[model samples]
Target: MDFEKLLVWQRAKALAVSLYKELANCGDVAFKSQITRSGLSVPSNIAEGMERFTNTEKRRFLSIAKASCGELRTQIMIGGEIGYIPALLADRWINETREISKMLSGLINRISD
Candidate 1:
């Protein structure tokens, strides 16, 4: 099965939507926008990468996706610091992000080998 078809990606997309909702109305508009931007980047990159016809293109996009996840992780931490998000919720998102990053990395490594 195509990695793109994985339910994790679907869940990630759903999760990102919820995340945006949570961040959008939060106080501090600038920080909210930044967090929302980084949060959306994960699935956006994945969808773009999955659409590519070439493996190299897919790999490159996955790399970008992974990087965005890292960015999201940092934004989330800062969100927590600023009281934008609760620790429990932040931990949950971070774990999911890390899992997705690992999955993408595994797939990319397999492609390279």
Candidate 2:
């Protein structure tokens, strides 16, 4: 199956694209870079995992992607509190990360089985 066809991958890619566009004008370079990297990691890892030859390899990459979701969520919360991100946008991204994490978990479980 193509990774791009997966809903989780599509949503994850969209989230990363949104972050990059939204933070394009951010003044804090470090914060912007960190958040965007983590956001990008989710879909990147998912695609990499799906391309792997073995289920174990796929699960490992999916797990890493799931962890990246948590990392991105934390950054979003801090960015929102620090005014780097708008309250509503932060909330939406946070929810998206949560959903992405859940989807990754489902993929990992399916791979395991």
Each prediction's TM-score versus the true structure: 0.88, 0.98
The lDDT of each candidate is 0.79, 0.96
Stretches > 4 Å off in candidate 1 = 1-4
**Per-residue C-alpha lDDT of model 2 across residues 1-113, encoded as one tens digit per residue:** 89999999999999999999999999999999999999999999999999999999999999999999999999999999999999999999999999999999998998863
- Please, what are the lDDT tens digits per residue for candidate 1 over residues 1-113? 45458664675687689788777668788887877787788888888877888889888987998898889888888887777898899888888888878987886786651
| TM-score attained by model 2 | 0.98
* TM-score (C-alpha, index-matched) for candidate 1: 0.88
Q: Pick by TM-score: which candidate is best? A: 2
Poorest lDDT segment (10 consecutive residues) of candidate 1 = 1-10
Q: How does residue 33 of candidate 1 score in lDDT?
A: 83
